[model samples]
Target: MRGDRVTNEGTVPSDSRRFCLYFAHIELAQKVQAGREAKRTLHEAGVAIKKQIIANTKSNKSERHKHLDELEQDLKILENELKEKEELKRQAEIPENAAKERHQKLWKVEKRAMQDLISRNNQMREMFADLDTNGDSLISIDELQKHRELDTNPENEFTVEEVRSILGSDSIDLNKFNTTVFDQLSNSYGKLLEPTRPTPEPTPLAEPSIDSITTQPSSLEIPTDEEDLRTHTRSSYKNEDDSEDDYEEYNHRGSSSIATSLEHEKHIHDSIAPEYDDETKRLIQIADEARNRYHEVGEKLLSIKRQIDDSKKQSSVDTGLHDEYAAIIDQCFDYEEREYTYRICMFKTANQIPKGGGSEVTIGYWDSWCGPKDNKYLKMKYSNGATCWNGPPRSLIVTLQCGTEQKLTDVREPSRCEYAMIFETPLACDETIATTSAHLDHVEF
Candidate 1:
């Protein structure tokens, strides 16, 4: 059967085949035309339909005006909804930005607050460390009890309530309780319990002024009484009588010689007075005043020296107390500038002065150390030193140390109105034979 179909093509059904071909051609042609019409319609429309629909819905004069009005109402509703949605979106974005800003501000504030807290904690720790007498990490109740006992008056023992009140709440920060409070308590107790040093009243010096001296002429004027006059007359009469006897004995006394002698005596008196010029008189008055002042100063110095000598004697007798001070002075003091009489005591005092100036003209001392007795060993002498321009004065304390040579190591003006200097002197060096031996032992073999 397969071979017979391959040989005869007329065996195919013509009516069905013709009908299928005709339908297929017609469908193809219709499809091609529909595609062209769709393309043309899209090109020609150019969004006009959308515009027309919008216009029709919006227009009042049209057959479907009522329906267009209904659509317009719907569109208005949709637009209102869209606006609400956009506002909601904006509100949501606002919160996000606000939240970010708030977070940044909060972070900075929190960071600073934490740092402040840490600083306060460190300060509290330091306070605690200062208070911890035993260097232990914790303050014991026994120690606190002992302190309470010491603080409480013997007549009025501390009650539990009082102790609790002083300690504050049980939840109090133990770290905050330091020796400062105890120290303050101790100071208060000392003030109440211990005897205080009596303040010495300053000795009022008899400062007799120049005006006082002028007012009291009797204090100044030398006495020229009848006794003095009588004594002078007797001496002069006796000398004249002796001279007359000699003249009588030697009758040829030269007249020129006598005249010359009188002239020479007058010249000597004139030289002594020098016609009393204003400058010379003023200088004489000054010298007199200076002499008086010098006498007063000498008396004062004698008194001071006696007091110092007495004190030294007393100190030598008090071996226990005075020995320490003596040892300290021995260790610390230094001398320099033997030619200019400059002396410096390290950690104690320094003084300098010109040659032949004596203690009165000395430049004065500068004390660097503050001792237990609060005894000041120096004076500033602001008025006495060399003056400075637009400033008070240029003053210095030459600090001394152990050295082989007398030399100035450094000079500094720490403030606008102050100066300091470091000096070296052989006197400060360890000159003992033992010290030298020790130094030799330390040296390389």
Candidate 2:
């Protein structure tokens, strides 16, 4: 090649320089080709592995589907049985409908009686307490007449003579309140008042009246406050000097008071003699028996129904969880805090960078989902990161809450080197977003 372009004692030529440039390009091309070949081999291996995984998943799903057919058949039988029972109960209910009216009336009457007595007793106790305010179980005639509330009405204001007759003196000792000496002194009441007819609970009354619901003694409206109507023991005291027999005798003295006491108890329980005819009673018994049977059948049907529902869920086609978590793959989120910049690389690593230009600290590495079993994907646990100065290795729990877009927020150390952060992500929403992969030709690797 040492022709006219070369010298006799040749050193270099312009054309020879082109040859150097050509070989340099060739060497660069060869290196690039070698790198592409290695990348291709690795890419092919990854594809093969992915196909095997897909095949295994399909095999597992097929095995699960085999039991699904039998489960569906069982579910159908249970559904039919449940429907039959429900129809039978509906038919039985039609016959029992007539008896229900009488039963409801009886229950209402009984409730009215109890509520009325309770109302009356509460009022009576309040009135007596107001009459004797000095903590002495004695009602003074002076206090009774001069009392501010008693001035409201004539009925509330009794004459001095009338008060003396009841007390046997100027003061009435409530300890001896049942003493019926006033009965001999005056003929104010010749006959017992008529038995009070039961009324609805909402009606306020001072005293039980024979006029039934038509009258409510306005002076002392019933304390309808539910707390005032509670049943309580009659609180009394017997000093050491008082003998047991004497105490018993004092409590037993007043005949009229005794009659009133017995009548009060009667009003509470045996107030209205429920008179159901023999036919009505027979109908009630039949209805009650039917109700019991209906309830038992209903409970059994519910149990079967729950099982069917659970079976249906188990039998449904398995939509592999692989897609459920695909949205989080390779996603990274950052949160700016007062003292640190927190970062979370989903299924990778979590780290916190100091705001004051210090080295970034490794918080943790993604381990597994640590949420409750019912919703396993709600939380992501990361563990075994850089060890703390005087504590165990670092760990983190990323709590996922449903959001329109992904975010890392509220980064904090719940305990020393035990980090926690809230992650708002659309992947946490109820519905999973499915994704598709597209193949591209002429890939470098």
Candidate 3:
């Protein structure tokens, strides 16, 4: 055995030798193709966003705004879809399964981007339909010039030469006609698209024809008395059933107040009956003066009714406050300052009466209700007052403080032409002192 071992070299059996190694089995060719396809899709979408269908380089603000808004919406949708597909792929454990699903998802996104391009082009087609007046699928320079003429301003004039230069042709096909040129035109002369109506035929002149003069109707009769005609000429607004008392009231008031009314009547009478004799005109004037007197009496009666209604409202006990302050609701709180006598009639308009003798001016009207229900006692806002000279409209805000007597303690102009007043009133307290003290005692126990 020693002689045989010396002559033969020992060799390890191939199957008995053990080896362990790790490597990724990635399909490089498939990955490279998928990456190229994704890059191509992204490039196509970029080109679509910058697609231009118009001849002119100028862009309208409105159209640009619309395109940008739509592009943003599309991009948002694309991002959401990509996130959803990525989540789905991550959930799949097998690499082959994930790659196949990702490829399908990416194809869908590419299709969507292509649709956006088609939709944008379709918008241009619809606009071309509006501009194609002859329906020959073309827009001529002459047609554009005619539309330009509709603009009244001389500076707005558009020439055939300008149109040809912009369009680069005498007639633009449907595709080119609906480009940026149409957008600029629509912005400048959109109103010209409205169809104009045909001019109406004029009526024949009312000449004294021989047939009309010969065939004068027998029933035609003109009134002789101008005074009777004038009385019938009274406005249809006059009442037919006016009471005798109203007529008596009209006679009691002197004619001096109606002198202006009489002058207006005379002017109207002269214009209506210029061909009438002086006596006729005078009679018409007298009748008009009597009608005016009746109108003046009616106006006075209306004024009396308004005053009575106002008095009733002031005396009513419907003030929305505590019983103690109910009397103050309708009563006026007069605050006399250096230059003006201010009156704040509760739940009514505030007024500023000049002390030295100027017109009474309205400060503002009460706009909000102030009380416990609103969790406020003294905050009152008055707005829409009479306009100030060289300033904004006057407004006032009143803040009420607790006091025994109702008075306006201080006034200040905190802003330009705006007055803020601190008013003191007994009604400003929500809870009595005795009640608050009792509540505090209970809490301490």
- Which candidate leads in TM-score? 2
TM-score of 1: 0.19
Residue-by-residue lDDT tens digits, candidate 1, 273-392: 113323334445555555555455455545545555544443343211212122223123333344444443332334444566665222324323322343222111212344456866
Instruction: Give lDDT: candidate 1, residue 67.
Output: 46
Please write out the lDDT profile of model 2 over residues 1-445, one tens digit for every residue: 4522655787545676767767777677677766655445444444454345456656654754565555566657766765776666666666455444433333343344445445544433344444566756666877565543333235654677755655578876533432332233223322223334443222233343323322222232222322321111011112233333333443343222222111233444554544444545666666666666666666765765675564454444232254345434556889997888888887778998899998988999978888898877778899998999988999999898655456875788879989999987545554221122222233221
Return the candidate ranking by TM-score, descending: 2, 3, 1
Model 2: weakest 10-residue lDDT segment is: 229-238
Candidate 2: where is the Cα deviation over 4 Å?
1-15, 80-172, 179-445
TM-score of each: 0.19, 0.32, 0.29
In angstroms, the error of model 1 at 291 is 26
lDDT, candidate 2, residue 190? 27
Clashing residue pairs in all predictions, respectively, total 1, 0, 2
What does candidate 3's lDDT look like per residue over 1-445, in tens digits?
A: 2222332566332322211111111334445546655544443433232222111112442443465556556555655655554454444324433333332332232233223323323444544555566777677777666665434455956776777876678988753543435445544555433323431112222222222222322231212354643342232113333323323333243211111111123223233311334444454455455545545554554554555455445445333333333445656888888998888877677888999998988888877644345645557777788899998888888887655466888777798768887877645543422122211111110
